[model samples]
Target: EAGVAQSPRYKIIEKRQSVAFWCNPISGHATLYWYQQILGQGPKLLIQFQNNGVVDDSQLPKDRFSAERLKGVDSTLKIQPAKLEDSAVYLCASSLATGWAIYFGEGSWLTVV
Candidate 1:
């Protein structure tokens, strides 16, 4: 079985530039998640989606960050006017909506230059 896929494993941008990252969850998985992990910190859930609908996004900074899941498959996250403090790893994980291990992708590292 193929694993979760993510792109732009590394990115460098100015403090005010906008950036986006993509994610492709595992096949047949019904739950997808986007997390932000700062250096030396644990992953913080940014958004959680069950199929095509959002289940939780309370931790997401809606004023500057946005995310979406399309057709219950791939997803994308974007940061507008990115801030220096936003430098961190964006991790994508997917689960089967049942009792099982959650698989994570190789996170996208954003560096505010």
Candidate 2:
């Protein structure tokens, strides 16, 4: 089984610029999550998806951040007019929908200058 795949691996942007990240979770997994991990902190749940529908997005900043899983297979997260505080590693994880050990991708590290 393939693990989650995220790209660019790293990003550098100026404050208030727009950026987007992509994720491909493990096949057959029913649960997908997007987390923002600041340096030295735990991964914060930005959004969670159950198949094609969103299950939890309360932690996501609606003002500038948004994510979607169109066909329940792949997902994309975007931040418009990025802030300096938004600089962090954006990770994507997948689980068996039962709280099993979630597998994580290498993450896309965004740095806003």
Candidate 3:
């Protein structure tokens, strides 16, 4: 099966800087999510989208992070004024819908200095 695709597999930025990551989910998936995995920690759901509408974003830090799935096929996550503690692997995942098996991309790694 085809897998999720993400760009700029790795990034290094100074604190207070900004960065963005893009993702393309497998075809036909209607549910998409963005997760943050700090070093040595499990991934935490940052936001979720069902088609072009947002399903959940309670865990996302609106003050610094933002995400959108405009057409529902591709998505982007952005962080502004990134902090050192924000360093982590940003994972993009997709599934048929809620409760379905999820497939993850290789992840975009962020290192804030």
Candidate 4:
């Protein structure tokens, strides 16, 4: 089965630094999501997009984090002035439809000192 594609499998930075993660969803998929996973906890949905339009982003920290899915296909997530608590795994996911089986890419690990 085809899955989402993500770049920079891992990243390390100090507090107050900035980083960006990229993602390419499966072809023909219409729903994309970005999730943050902390140690020992389930993934937390940060943003969701449908056909390049944001469907949900209430959990995203707008002050220091931002994401975009252009042309309803590729996406990017950026965090500026990251904090220690922000160290976590960023997951990219996509699916043909909501409520269906969603496939996830290998998470991007972020570590902030």
lDDT tens readout by residue for model 2, 1-113: 67899998999999989999999999988899999999999999999998989999999999999999999989999999899999999999998784777899999999999
Taking all chains together, each candidate's TM-score versus the true structure is 0.96, 0.97, 0.97, 0.96
Candidate number with the higher TM-score (2 or 3): 3
Worst 10 residues of 3 by lDDT: 1-10
lDDT tens digits by residue: candidate 3, 1-113: 78999988999999999999999999999999999999899999999999989999999999999998999899999999899999999999999998899999999999999
Residue 79 in model 2: shift from native, Å?
Answer: 0.1
Top-scoring candidate (lDDT): 3
Per-residue CA lDDT of model 4 for 22-111, tens digit only, reads 999999999999999999999999999998999999999999999998888999999998999999999999988787789999989999
After TM-score superposition, what is the CA distance of residue 12 in candidate 1 from its true location, in Å?
A: 0.3
Candidate 4 Cα outliers beyond 4 Å, as residue runs: none
Candidate 3 to truth, TM: 0.97
**Model 1, range 45-104, lDDT digits (tens) per residue?**
999999989999999999999999978899999999899999999999999983567899
Positional deviation of 56 in candidate 3, in angstroms?
0.9
Residue 25, candidate 4: Cα error in Å is: 0.7
Q: Which RMSD does model 1 reach against the true structure?
A: 1.0
lDDT of 3: 0.96
Model 3 clashes, total count? 0
